[model samples]
Target: MDGLTGLLDGARARGAFLLRSVLDPPFALRIEDRAPLTVVALVRGAAWVVPDDGEPARLDLGDVAVLRGPDAYTVADDPATPPQVVIHPGQRCTTLRGEPLTSTPGLGVRTWGTGPDGSTVMLTGTYQLPGELSRRLLTALPALLVVTGDDWRSPLVPLLAEEMSRDAPGQEAVLDRLLDLLLIAALRTWFARPGTAPAWYAAAGDPVVGPALRLLQEDPARPWTVAALAAEVGVSRAALARRFTELVGEPPMTFLTGWRLTLAADLLREPDATVGAVARRVGYGSPFALSAAFRRVHGVSPSEHRIGAATGD
Candidate 1:
């Protein structure tokens, strides 16, 4: 897999919270949901995304904005509008005073707003939990990033909006895949913009290092060494090492180890996963060996990680 695809593989949305929001003017939401990520698409009227630590971004019709969260932000018709509602964890809605907000009426399936004929329309998809590989992508983003219609144009928003209100079997799975596609497309466009691509992303286009990265990520269980990787990539060992380090900011083996451990860590989160199984899957010879390396990098053993993941601690 390519760098972008490999990074996004772990971030696929499954039963994510999605909704079509219709509203009139003077609408604002103080979002402290602590979700890892959220995608907002302005379908009709305009809106503003105000981040706590970054400059406010204006979203015109057909624009999409991605908010990397765990930090607070506000979405409103205007930047000056005060938030009338606060979105809490678990997708709870309440007034600024913490009283449950019952005034917002349901417009239709998977939609809520003041009324169906509200002037502004927006579609929102929130990833409530962090993905296994999302850490790499999230670290490369700012608090908020906006992609305008003029920069990148696609029918994803309209398509997703139509799918939002549908009631049928397996609809949630469909929406999940759609949301993943929209997010992938948006990030792909965003990363293509000047000065926005991360180091690993940018390095993926290099002829020498790109294939090497794919090899490491595609088969983490393979026992790989510098000479083996270099021979496979048709480069001398020293040349491959120098170029990989210069471009990827790490040696081949170091990158391999990190990739292996990342997979192991994610696998251990599964309730049925055992350390021995995870170790074998990620290329370690024994659970003890994997534990030592996992602790050094993650600061926790596999079992400890599973517990913490389950408890959200």
Candidate 2:
């Protein structure tokens, strides 16, 4: 159910990118220093994208990359041999095409970006994450992933393409959300690959562990004991622990604890949910115990989590 649950949640957190003419080029653009979780999809022509820690990569249509850190990187057509004339972040962008992309009066939502040849080479856009799970996903994604030219018939892509032709109300917000879902699909498909990946990603490949993970994800507070869970899948507790540790990098209980805490944190963020309610939801009988454990893990109490979460922390 973790995979299915992830799919559903991902469908909700989707976002998008639209290109307006004001910033159209004959000019260049850079990230301008301040770092945010950026998902850049090259929906048009190919360009050279340079990350701080990595070399310049060729980003073409359907190519997606997440700029993990805030380090500024140059995304331009040419390999900045001498680099372009630079300016400060949030300061004057000295690039010739400094006009506002969205301010272009004739630009429409169903419109597209124009390439150097005046052809719609790409439909590029960028977005940031909404939830912690999504943020973690952004961090975990490879620096560059090009999903183009039949890289699986992505439902997200068609959704994006179809949206571009519609004349609906609140279309921009709708497009952005759809873009976020595309990211989740891309991430999911990436993790479904085998060999050489993080433990959690690799865990998706283990027959028993995969099912077990789904079970845990389905209901974190279901009084799941190691012995019972192991037996449910016809393995001894020790065998289950060994397999889980090998693939998931933590014993089942430890993984469950972390997952429960994540759910508990989400619950704590709810305005109507109290400490005791969150505690019970996460499998604890006492708020005191949950608070103590939560503080030990998060360096704050349930109350702090509620307050911080309420304020969009």
Candidate 3:
């Protein structure tokens, strides 16, 4: 798989929180939910996404906004609207004074809002915990990215809205996949726009470094060297190294090591996986070697990381 695809593939949603929010004008929501990532598609009417640290951006009908979070932001009918609702972590809803609002009658399946016929309708999908691999993709994004409706065309948003209210068996799994598709489609369109794509994303089109990056990502378990990678991609070691570093902003081997260790960190989270097993899987020769490298990169041993993860520290 290519680098961009691999990065997004890791973001497969598990029990993602999806909702259709119906609201009237003169409404605002202070979203301090601190979710790792959120995608908001305006199904009707318009709204403004005001990030705490960035300029406010408006979302028109059919426009989708992707927000990178754990930070607070506000969504409202207008930039000047005061927040009436505060959405807390875990998708809990409350008034500005903290009275519970979840008990407010639902408009329909997987839908909630101030009223059934509110003027503005929006679909929200939150990736509550984006795993280690997806974090790589998320890190490259700005705090708020909006794919204008006029610039990109897709049927996924309407399909997602249609499927969201269903209650059939395996419905959640279906929604998860749909959410992934929507995100990928939106990102592909966003990255294709001039001057918006990140460096790594743009480098994926390079003849030499592009293939080299794919090789590294495709089989990170392979014990790869600069010369070996160059040979595989049909370039001289010096040429590949210079070009890869220039485009990717890191030496090839350094990037590979980081990739391997990242894979190792994720593998270590598996309940049945042993440190030695994860080491071999990520290209390390032994647990001790992996431990040293992990410590150097993450400032924690694999065991400590696992313990902290388990304890939620």
**lDDT winner:** 3
- Output the lDDT of residue 115, model 1: 93
Q: How much is the lDDT of residue 110 in candidate 1?
A: 83
Clashes of 1: 0
Which residue pairs in model 3 clash with each other? none
Question: What TM-score should be assigned to candidate 3?
Answer: 0.90
lDDT of predicted model 3: 0.86
- lDDT tens digits, residues 157-190, model 3? 9999999979999999999999888988998888
lDDT of 2 by residue, 79-100 (tens): 6633343323332344434544
Give stretches of model 1 more than 4 Å off: 131-136, 269-272, 307-313
Cα-based lDDT for every prediction: 0.85, 0.60, 0.86
Candidate number with greatest TM-score: 3
Per-residue lDDT for 219 in model 3? 86
Q: Which of candidates 1 and 3 reaches a greater TM-score? A: 3
Ten residues in sequence with the least summed lDDT for candidate 3: 129-138
Better of 1 and 2 by TM-score: 1
